[model samples]
Target: MQVSPVDDSLEQTELRGPRARTRKLMLDTAIALMQKGQTPSISDVAEAAQVSRATAYRYFPSQAALVHAVVDAGLGPILEWHSDSNDAEVRVQDLLKTSMPRILEFEATFKAALKLSLEQWAERQAGTFGDEPPFKRGHRVEMLQKAIAPLKHTLTEFQFQRLAKSLSLVYGLELLLVLKDMWGLEFEETQDIAAWTAGALVRTAIAEAGV
Candidate 1:
């Protein structure tokens, strides 16, 4: 029998054994702290997870990396969401309806991520930010574009992008921050308003496009 060379790259990419468990422990600890309204640092997570600071640093070198990982884990479902409906409006509504609860559940963690992003921005503006990796956001852009994909043929490129941009305002952490925090609305009310606004935007776009 002829033997083929084994691919080491796959093994390298997969976290297994103790390393995987340690990384997951840090992530879980960070999530628990963030959910309790605390923006934990790597050291904080290390102490909480009962791992050494050095070990935690090996997994996440900076606070940005830590928060980014935590956010990714928290929003995993939302990030991986897809809709089967062909109607753009239906897709948009389904996304809002499905994602709102999860968004609310991780509201504190997302807010912490947002705070870190703003802090990084301010530091950059003041010329204090060095080579630290920035905590990047904007997942909603792609999600909105995908949700409205069915309308691509009916609308122009500009119309499609504009509708997506408008819908972005009603989704994500900002929506919860505004509707819940500023307006003091409950989760159900916030979701209802978001769904309505998303539906209205889709209808308006289609109407104006004459489709």
Candidate 2:
């Protein structure tokens, strides 16, 4: 039997026995392949990552799984950006700005994944009357609740509700799709627009509450 060079090289990397390293290698290859206008099929990814097809499949069973991994992996930097800001206002801006650049940075995998997610969400809404969506149920509500934490001290009960509603409405996948696909904006510019939009929304919400 011919020992595939890709499989052999990966076995050597596996000798160190750090699972995360291997996973990272696979994900990086997937992203790179996707970036080059390649569809990132399993065999292609396996070959690029220098891993056996079996090993690659062990980490990601399907194309969806591979795509999701790439998307989730790409989110790491944005998540860190949000976490490091630690300021609700700044974090909010960072999150919004990330929508465009972040997606563009991982355009292929993200575009593919986003399309699938949208389709699934639409299907669920039609079939179940909005019982489930791919983006965790109540994610917007939860994010809105967090975004306004700083202003809660100055807000009345009604004002708080308005703030939450505004937060939930201003951000999320719709904005991402619009900036990435519709407007043809680049990463930095998308972030700038998102930050401006979010900041303006926040101000409006605050004023509406008379705070």
Best-performing candidate as measured by lDDT: 1
lDDT of 1 at 95: 88
C-alpha-based local distance difference test score of model 2:
0.65
Which regions in candidate 1 have their CA more than 4 angstroms from the true location?
A: 1-16
Q: lDDT of all the models against the reference?
A: 0.90, 0.65
Best candidate according to TM-score? 1
lDDT by residue (tens digit), candidate 1, 102-188: 888899999888888888899999999989888888778888999999999999999999999999999999998898999999988
- What's model 1's TM-score? 0.90
lDDT of 1: 0.90
lDDT of candidate 2 over 1-211, digit per residue (tens): 1224667667787766777688879988988876665656678899998999999888887766787667667655553443354345665665566544565566666556666566667777688534322432234465556655677777787777776776655565555567756888665665677678778877776676675
TM for every model, in the order presented, reads 0.90, 0.60
Q: Model 2: which ten-residue window has the lowest total lDDT?
A: 129-138
